[model samples]
Target chain A: MPSTAEPDALSAGAKRGRPGYDQDSVLNVAVQVFNKHGYDATSMGLLAENLGISKSAIYHHVPSKGDLLRLALDQALVPLEAISEHERARTGTAEERLEFFLRSTIRVLIERQPYVTLLLRLRGNTEIERTALERRRAVDRKVADLVVEAQREGTLREDIDPRTTTRLLFGTINSMVEWFRPDGPAGAQQVEDNAITMMLDGLHTRNL
Target chain B: MPSTAEPDALSAGAKRGRPGYDQDSVLNVAVQVFNKHGYDATSMGLLAENLGISKSAIYHHVPSKGDLLRLALDQALVPLEAISEHERARTGTAEERLEFFLRSTIRVLIERQPYVTLLLRLRGNTEIERTALERRRAVDRKVADLVVEAQREGTLREDIDPRTTTRLLFGTINSMVEWFRPDGPAGAQQVEDNAITMMLDGLHTRNL
Candidate 1:
C-alpha cells in the first residue's frame, strides 16, 4: 500500500522530512495519540504531527488508523497467546496453570498499560474493535477451560459454575489497568503476589 | 432554571404541547440514549426527540443533561448507600457485613442494570461525573474497611492488602453489567449464590 516500490524515496526524503522513524516507533506514537484523543476523533495527520513526520511518512509505516489499532491489539494479544504456550502454562496442574496465567496478565498490564487500556475500552463499533473483542473472549475461554479442568480434578469447587468463576477472575485481573501504575507504591511484583494470594487462597484466614 | 417560571404556561398548554412523559420514564430513556451515543455526544434535543416531547417540556422535569446524569447516578448510588446502612451491614460481624454488602450489590446491579451500566462506564469528564466517581470511591473504601476489620478479627487473611481484596471484590461484582441479561440463563439469585461461594469459600475443595 505504501510506495515501498520507490525504494529510493527514503534517500530522497521529502523536503519536510524532519527525521526518519521506524514502523514500530510510529505505531507506538499512533497508539498513544489514539488513546488520548479517542479513535474516532484521531486522524492520521495528528499522528504524523505527533511523530514529527510527514503524513506520507506516517502512511509509509502504517496504512491506516485501523491498522494501527490492529497492531496495538497484537501487542496485547501476542503476549497472552504466548502465556498459553509457556512451559508453566502447558505442563502444570490446572490451578498452577491458572496462577501462571494471572501472573503473566499482571506483567502484561504493567508492560503494555496504554495498549491494554485501549483494548479494554474498545467499544466494538468497528471491524477492528470486534476482532479484538473476539480475541479477548477466546483468551477468556481458555481460562474458563482451566477452571473446568481444575474443578473436574476436584481442586476447585463444583458448586460454582466454571463460566461464572472465569468471568470473575477475568474481571478482577482486567481491572488492574484501571489503577495499577508501575511507579505507584505497588510494583508489578507486588500486584502479582497479591493477585495470586487473593485468587488461590482468597481473603479468608487459612490459619494453620 | 427551566421556564417552569411559567407555571401557568403549563395550564396554557405549552402552545406547542406534546404528550407528557413522567420524570422516571424520561430518565430511563435518557440512560439508554446516553449509553448508546455516549454521554458527551448526547444532547438535550436528542433526548427530547427520543422521548417524543418538546425540548422546553423536557426541561420541566430535569433542568439539563447534567441533571439527568445526576438523577441516574442517584438511582445507582442511593441503593448502595442504603446497603451500607442496612441492619446487617451495621450490626453484623465484619465478615457478615461484607457478605451483606456483596449480596446487596448483586441485587442492585441486577435490578438497575442499565443505570448501573452507565455508572460503571462514566469517565469523570464533567462535574456530575466527578461527584459520582467520588461517591463510588467512598463506597469502595467502606468495603475495604470491612476487609481490614475482618482481617484484624482473624476472619480474613492478613497477608493480602485490604485495599487489594476490596478492588478484586468490586471488580467481580461490577463486571456483571458486561454479561448479565435478566432473560438469560443465569438468574440474579444464582449469581448471588455463586459470588458468595467463590468469594468466601474460594475455588479449592475443602476435602470434606
Candidate 2:
C-alpha cells in the first residue's frame, strides 16, 4: 500500500537514504511479492517491511491492500481495453482482426506479466476480486463477440462454438502467467509469437 | 465421513417407503449438499436433518465430515488414476495418445462431475485440501511428462513450451465445471467432440 503520500513522508518525515522510490516503484515490488505469495497470504505489513519503510509511511498514496489490488487489475484491464478500439481490430476482416486482437493480448499480458498474473489469479473472495473477475468476463464476452462475428463472416469453422473457442483461447492466454517467467528460457516476443501461431492455426479458416 | 463401518447402519437408517434408498443413494444426496454448502459450511447435524435421520444414525455410516471429502476425492481420483495406465495412452503415438487422453479426460471429468468439481474448488487450507492438490498436481505432471515426450518426438508443437501448453489445455478443460450443466443446451457428446476438435486443430500440424 505504499502510495505517493508514503514517499512524501520519507522526505518530510524521519527517514534516511530513502532513495528515489516512487508510487510505481513500490507498486512494482508489491506486485512481485503478491504474485510470489498469493494475495490472501500477503499482508501490508510485509510489503511495508520489504520497502524498508514504516507502516504509516507506506500509506501515503494507496489507502489499503485493496487499493493496490484495484491498481493491479486496472493495469491488466487497459491492454484489452485498447484492443477493442485498435484500428486493426475494428477495420479488418474478421480473421485479421481476431488474430491481431489475440496477438496483441498475448503481448500485453507478457509485458504486464506480473500484474496480469495477479489479475488472472483472483478468485472472487473479496469485492476487488469480484470486480476483477467481472471485468475479465466482460473482456471475454467481447472477444466471444468477435469470434461470433468471424463465424458470421464465414471466416472460422462452423463446427466449433465461438463461446467455447473464445474461452479456450483466452484460457491459454490467461495461463501465460502461471508458467511464463520473464527470466526464464523463453523471451517475451518468442512466447507471444509462438502462442499466436498455434492459436491462429487452430482457429483460422483452412482457405485463409 | 461415511466409512466401511456403518454401511449396515446407514442402509438400515434410511427412511422407509423408498425401495431404492440405500447408503449409496444417501451418499449421493450428501455429496450434492456438501458441494453446494461447501465442506466447512456443512455439518453432520444439517446433513442428518436433510436425510430425515438422527445424527447418531447418520454417524453409523460415516465416521466424520472429512470422510465425505475422502469419498468424494476418491471418486474423482479414480478416473484420473485410470487414465495413466490406459492402453492407448501408453502404446499409441504421442498425438494419438494425447488426443485419446484429452477425450477420455473430458469423459471422466463429466462422469465424476460433482466429485471433480469439489476437487477443483479445494482451497488447500486443510490437510485434505493440500493432499488433494498434491495429487491433482501429480496427475497434471503426468500429462506434462507426455507433453515433454511429444515435444521430444517432434509430434507436438515445439514453438510453444509444453508446460505452458499443458496448463492452458487443462485450464480450459477444468473450467468446464464452472458452466457445464448436464441438462444444458449441449450434451456431453457435443461438448466432448467440440473440445477435442478444437484442441486437436490447435495442437496438430497446421497444414494437415
Tens digits of lDDT, candidate 2, A113-184 = 888988876778899899888988887887888888877887677777676677667766776766688887
Q: How far off is residue B110 in model 1, in Å?
A: 1.9
Q: State each model's CA lDDT, in order.
A: 0.79, 0.73
Task: Write down the worst ten-residue block by lDDT for model 1 chain A.
Answer: A1-10
Predicted complex 2: CAPRI docking category: acceptable
**lDDT tens per residue, model 1, B130-182:** 99999988988899999899988888877777776787788778888887778
TM-score for each predicted model, relative to the true structure: 0.87, 0.73
- Could you tally the backbone clashes for each prediction? 0, 9
Top lDDT prediction, candidate number: 1
Candidate 2 regions exceeding 4 Å error are A1-22, A25-59, A64-66, A121-134, A202-208, B1-61, B64-66, B121-130, B148-160, B203-208
Which residue segments of model 1 deviate by more than 4 Å? A1-20, A52-54, A206-208, B1-20, B206-208
Fnat for every candidate: 0.52, 0.28
